[model samples]
Target: MPEEKQQTPPGSETEMNVKPDHGEQSYVGHGRLQGKATLITGADSGIGRAVALAFAREGADVLISYLNEHEDARETERLVREAGRKAVLVAGDLADPAHCRSLVDQAVQAFGKLDVVVNNAAFQMSHESIEDIPDEEWNRTFAVNISAMFHICKAAVKHMKPGGSIINTSSVNSDKPSPQLLAYATTKGAIANFSAGLAQSLAEKGIRVNSVAPGPIWTPLIPATLPPEKVATFGQETPMKRPGQPAELAPVYVLLASDEASYISGARYAVTGGTPIL
Candidate 1:
């Protein structure tokens, strides 16, 4: 018998030859986000799945926003419900400003209120140099990563009361640029600046905005975005010598979304496997 071909570019967990470990059983929570309603983009797999599981465990009803990957999204929905919380799946291209507005509106409509908005959806392509970067890809990268955040925040804030939280997923590449991933890095830098600026602007309303800049973590993006050789040595360059797990990053999201981080805003938390950002 011949082997089935594997899907690429945000591979589906249900179709993956060996399912990527999403930390559903391993992540532990202490109800830090209890009663909060969180909407997470790219929630079907990888870091988004990890965060979704963690949020559900902490007693939050989650609205999962994903693009395609229906099987993975269904699995995420299953896991969220299994964690004893509600999960609402919102599917579409977040690159659209209208869709971004709808994401916040649908979540608020379904959950009655929106407390945490996690802008985690993104796309990246690796090229050896900036000259090789496609203009369309560069523009799309910024649209999905930074523009979508802007849209979601603008729409969600209308219904988000005081103490609402917005957590954007920046990347280590924001501060430490990866020459090959020029366009992707640029968007991440913008996300960092946007988070800081939005945090300050929303301070008077008591709505906190922050960002998480993760170092190399084992995710589907590794294989989808990088060459196979690069994928094989993905996190080897990090000081930890291994990519950080999604489970490891989940707690940071929980902390930032919880009342425990009441005093925190406009801060960037680097979960980059001992990679010094300074």
Candidate 2:
């Protein structure tokens, strides 16, 4: 990690110093998600991009929901198409409830049905004190991180049939809070709880719901939110002594989305580089 790396909010992968590996060259699929219709928020970069790539190769048509990173989103769309799958790009703010619902509708419209939903988009900022956090920033974090997931699921479940899967992106912060990321960490905790409760409620409908809690991964979000000094030493605290790549987290998401995990739900899968979630 470089000491002088930083970026504006909602960062771009094209602008990264050392690009994160999205399993572009290494991932080989066997049609695990064959003919599935999927929608993924934040698919423009980071874990979202990696998941989109994996799903595409696994035979799923993807609807990519991103913020404003057109270049990054286009790159992801290219990867999906390259894998011989359909990819639709939809750019908007996930903080809006209306936009969240619209994303599911668009995916259903594009593929004629929706089978999987990955609520992975999130916003975070570093603050030394609670007083330094803005009321709007706090509200915005919850809106994009957890509220959007709820709204999207509400709309998607109607279109999804049995065997559908909903995967939410929780964080290591959900279990191990980071003081500087107070607002972001708070919402992550809420996401874990929300996923748990939602999973139980959706069980009767045969819709599996689960959450993935990722530790420090080498993504644009690192430089975008943390200071340069902190970014340089990012992931040092992990037992692996390095940050996990986006590609490393992809297989977990792929498994959850596939029918192989039909009996698994209401669980939190942690990709924390040996850091325990509990």
Candidate 3:
């Protein structure tokens, strides 16, 4: 990767210098999630988009929730539709608790019931020190990253049946903290703990809950949050010496969403290019 200028937080995927591979060409589905009704936050791009596409190809109808990235969201919708599945788009800020609940409501309304929920939307910013992180930024990070997941799940559980699944997008930082991403890292750690506790609580209900902790990945978030210098060498620290692509993480999500992972819950799967979480 080369040095690149930063975009605003929650960057636009279409504007990326090197477009991410969201399994547009490589992924092959096997009816793993056939006929399932799913809701995925941040489905506009990155891992979320990849999951949406994969789910569609696997025979699931998807409701895509985004944060005002219309162009990116539409592209994701097109991919879902292209895979011959239903796609619903909802744009709103996850920081607002009302919006979070509405996401679940809309998904249930659109699909009649929710079989899977992917809490993938997140807000992040890098700073040199704690003092540089503003109060509002810290609060917003937690609101979008972790709080939204809680609200969405609370509303979705009633709509979901015994075979439902919930997958949260955590980060390697949950185990190996990154000083530059203090707020974001903290929220990720909270998400891991939250998923663990929630999984045990929901076990009797038969709703599986898990987290995916990704290492450096080639996404718009890379250029948007990290400094140009750091962006240039992103993911090199991993043994793979390169970042994992959005497409690379979709299969794990597919398994979790599918009935195949019936016995898998309360676990955090790491896709870190050989970088171990512990």
Note the Cα lDDT for every prediction shown: 0.88, 0.94, 0.94
- What TM-score do all the candidates reach, one by one? 0.95, 0.99, 0.99
Q: Write the per-residue lDDT of candidate 3 for residues 1-278, one digit (tens) a residue.
A: 54567898788887788889999999998999999999999999999999999999999999999999999999999999999999999999999999999988888888888999999999999999999999999999999998899999999999989999999999999999999999999999999999999999999999999999999888888888888889888888999999999999999999999999999999999999999986
Which clashing pairs does model 1 show?
A: none
Q: In candidate 2, which residue pairs get closer than 3 Å at backbone N, Cα or C atoms, i.e. clash?
A: none
Query: Which portions of model 1 show Cα errors greater than 4 Å?
Result: 1-7, 15-19
Tens digits of per-residue lDDT for model 2 on 1-278?
Answer: 55545799878888888899999999999999999999999999999999999999999999999999999999999999999999999999998899999999899889999999999999999999999999999999989998999999999999989899999999999999999999999999999999999999999999999999999998888889998888888889999999999999999999999999999999999999999997
lDDT of 1: 0.88
TM-score of 1: 0.95
Output the better candidate (1/3) by lDDT.
Answer: 3
lDDT of 2: 0.94
